[model samples]
Target: MFTNLLAFHSIFRWLVLAALFATCILFVYKHFTNKILSLKDYRFLQVVCLILNIQFILGVLLFSKSQLALLFWDNFQETVKLRQPRFFGLEHPSMMILGILLFNCFTFKIRNKINTKEAFTYFSKRFILILIIILSSIPWSFSPLTHRPNYRSLELTNF
Candidate 1:
């Protein structure tokens, strides 16, 4: 059960990352190009936000039961500052939550603005800030302490 959950989370990160990047780019484009915020724009944000919310919920369930929580409880702030603990326990979850907040804020602020352009402009900048936060928080294997089990992409080799 744990392994299956781990695999699901590992693969799901890619989708979350892709959606995050797309939303970031769209926001940037809107800022630079002064594009109008159409229904499509809001729809895109909604889709990505929904995915992120799910990912976050999954992570919470996984971490709360695992040894990771034990470690986090023991070390708290110090654990979160380090690579492995930070990634799994703090960075990934906090940044994702922060991203959700940004999206919600944008939706709230822009849903009924009389000046669509100004509302969009506000949203774009807010989006960029969240993107930066998310980018910093992703857990790549590059970190030395990333010791989650069974991350191999194996294949049969011919001798």
Candidate 2:
């Protein structure tokens, strides 16, 4: 079950990333090109918020069950001193929660139906900010510190 959660979390990241990029970059082509926000633009943002919300929930569950997190909690000071432990235990989760907050905040504003042009302007910038936060926090395989695979198999990382 833990391995299943790990795999799901790993695979789900792609969906989250793609949705983020589409909403912040691709779908907002109108805003970038000096056009107004279409109805679909609103939907795109909504979709990303939903995806991120679910992802955040999954992350919370995974974190609660993760051995690394347990070790970090039991050995706070020592674990924090190490790069990989610190990245996984503190940095990544915090940044991801921050991203979720930013995402929900923007979604709230849009759902309230503010001026279309102003909302588009706001969303484009806000979306980009959250995207950057999430992108930076992701532990890519190539990262020197706290790297993980593009996909997780049955075995979870011990580090």
Off by over 4 Å in 1: 28-33, 74-83, 144-159
Error of 2 at 90 (Å): 1.4
Please write out the lDDT profile of model 2 over residues 136-155, one tens digit for every residue.
99999898877899986655
TM-score of 1: 0.74
User: Each candidate's TM vs. the true structure?
Assistant: 0.74, 0.88
Clashing pairs in model 1? none
lDDT per residue for candidate 1 within 20-68, as digits (tens), equals: 8887788678779877777777778778878877887778778876676
Candidate No. with top lDDT = 2
Best by TM-score: 2
lDDT of each: 0.71, 0.81
lDDT of 2 at 132: 89
